[model samples]
Target: MVSLSLGELISSHRSRRNLSLSDLAEMSGVSKSTLSSIESGETKRPSYTTWKKIADAMDIAPSTIINAFVDTTYHPKTLEIVLAEVIREGWEALVAKVAIRYLESPRIDTFRALDHIDGTARDTENKRIKRILCDSIITFTRSRGIPSYLASALYERYLIERDDFSRFEETYRRGKELLLYTEHLYTEDRIDYYYKMGVHANILGLHDESIELCRLGLREDRTDSKQKASAYISLFNSCVYFGDIHVAAIYLKEYENSQYADFRKNHFRATLLAKKGQHEEAIELFRVCLQEAKKEGRISIVVDLMASYLEAGKTDELLRLIESEDQFLPEATPQHPYRMKTLAQYYRRKALCLISLEKFDQGFHSLSESIKYFKQLGTTSEVIDGIRLFLRHHRTNNKNLSFKNMEILEDICDNII
Candidate 1:
């Protein structure tokens, strides 16, 4: 599904009704500030009363917003962009076509199209022309179901660079299917396809699927322990997502002793500890991971381990590291481990941290951001409950919004083509 960003969904609904945020806020008994935050995904969890009021005010079944929030992986942003594009282009048929494709193909086809770029260099090597021709031929073959594994592989890479994983799982599905149907398509071609998908699934909160796919590679491919171990570690990470700490422990143990482990085991081990409520120990473990990864010259791994250290509340270590200012740090920091699931959780936790630090606005901002991503990702039901409560407490004044506006908006959304 084309996930609509939180901003897009709320704005579209507001715009079509010709209702201002202030107007809606007034009618729903929601505070303007709170409504803005909820609309923006900042206040990650709205209280029960808050959402009920917004639902009641908007005349939308509280269930529509509630269900939208619970669907966890709903395509809110996708819907937003398509809606906006339709509005811009005045192509109602195109909008309809996209919606149909969205519901039908949903994942793979969308990623392929979104990630498709041309006249770009995959590598700057001696066979530049060959890579270009290969990408072209691959794209063409995959389009017609000709088992062009290379094309699918290239498309997967494109998705990674762009960070557009709305259809991540779908691409993995299509790529895997093609590989299965055409054994000849199995070259050691797209290790990243497997690895990145594992990462994306972890981010999106599909931990089981993530680990399972990694296992598919570890068992099926000729990768050595190094590669296999990462895949295994990925599976270990998923155990946390599914909320089975003991299972995570079992997998963490496996990863810790793996011949494939390259000091990165420290971070993974620490992650398991943190999840198991051994937070203090986990913090120390990740500190060692940071040092070891730095020692091993694994830039990406070091960045990752550092993030884990930061997340697990290894505060003193973070402070000391900050004071020391490792001049050799990467240009950018790594994101939280899951990057997929629990985005709102990240914001919620961050907000708590900010609150503890007495940074009220910053804390609120963090929570609001969390709320937004949660809305985007369709957070857990517990989160939706909170959002609803927050909204009901809000006292917006716009009591009557016309369905005519919403209809106009949907028509505009349908014109994205």
Candidate 2:
């Protein structure tokens, strides 16, 4: 597509705004002589600060002011020149929209462009705007599965939100690395990081680390309901994981009036019931939760309900639940992280059910499949757990099974890791 020159863009916007060179100079704080030089094509590459002042004076994005100079392929160059300006002028939201639009172009290396913008804005003084812009770029990168350090942190958050514990240990470590890049993280992002890392730590059996992380999130000020909800949920779960039911209950009560109280409250209440040995009540609550989650089409919760049922020894019911969901095809979209996670857990649950029913061969094959899925999913922790689970069941059920098959399953699990 043919594009206007930077000089033409600036002159056109200035004319449309009905501002003379002197008037523009007065509004933008740029000398009329320099404005004339830019508009007349004498100053071909005005500094970012100058372009920003003019864009601000014209009530336009710096990108709009210089769009003529930025083709789809040169979009990052535009960002590199003005990201700091965009942040300093509190135009993060506007510029982020522009950047996202540029990302939609198929010819661009969008991830590399975002990375470039990040690097260019590294020294920008406004932390709040920097944080906002950082979140935008990282969020885009994460949703597209583009690998970058910040995007990886958000990906871990995504995994935790989906209740995928397959990589909890690695997630915790990566979250620590994420902390080192905190200069550009907003308060909400920090809260999200702490709570998510806290959950991962809790899953890794690092109770103290989890508690500290949750406390850090709670200590952040000006948190809204959703943010506070996350912190509270993290604290409650951490306490429960540590067997501090009293503390967990206290945290739970603290959020009883939350907007999320119904689903969140009931889910944890069921957990508390299970912990208190009220199996039937817990199972009933989970069944209700399962129905609600299904009605809402909450796949993560559905998968979680399957795990809860299996934990409660409702094997047949769990199998039936899995079978009933046509949407639970884990192998359908391997590129989708949530589906892949669900697939791993789905097969793992199926294997456990088969083993319990003394379907030894089918159970071993399913276990092998689960381990393979977890390995392909790059979750070392899940792979190890799968191996240990196989070993435990194999030891118990070996006499009733073919020795060669067991050996093959062991080799399959071992070879993948």
* Model number with the top TM-score: 2
- The numbered model that scores best in lDDT is 2
Instruction: Report the lDDT tens digits of candidate 1 across residue range 102-142.
Output: 33334445434433322222332223332333344355455
Model 1 gets an lDDT of 0.52
Instruction: Judge candidate 1 at residue 25 and give its lDDT.
Output: 80
Instruction: Pick out the ten consecutive residues of candidate 1 with the lowest summed lDDT.
Output: 117-126
TM-scores, all models, native as reference: 0.43, 0.51
Give lDDT per model, in order. Answer: 0.52, 0.65
Query: What tens-digit string does per-residue lDDT give for candidate 2 at 1-417?
Result: 345665686778877978798998999899999999988988876765687688788887554654543332334445554444555567655556545555554556766666555664454556555455556666676578555446443533443333433444454565575665544567666677777667556545567787888788778745446756766776787788778999999989976856755575777788788778777788788777666654433444555566667667777787787677674353254654434555667778778877888887777788877777767655677788987888888787655446876676566566453
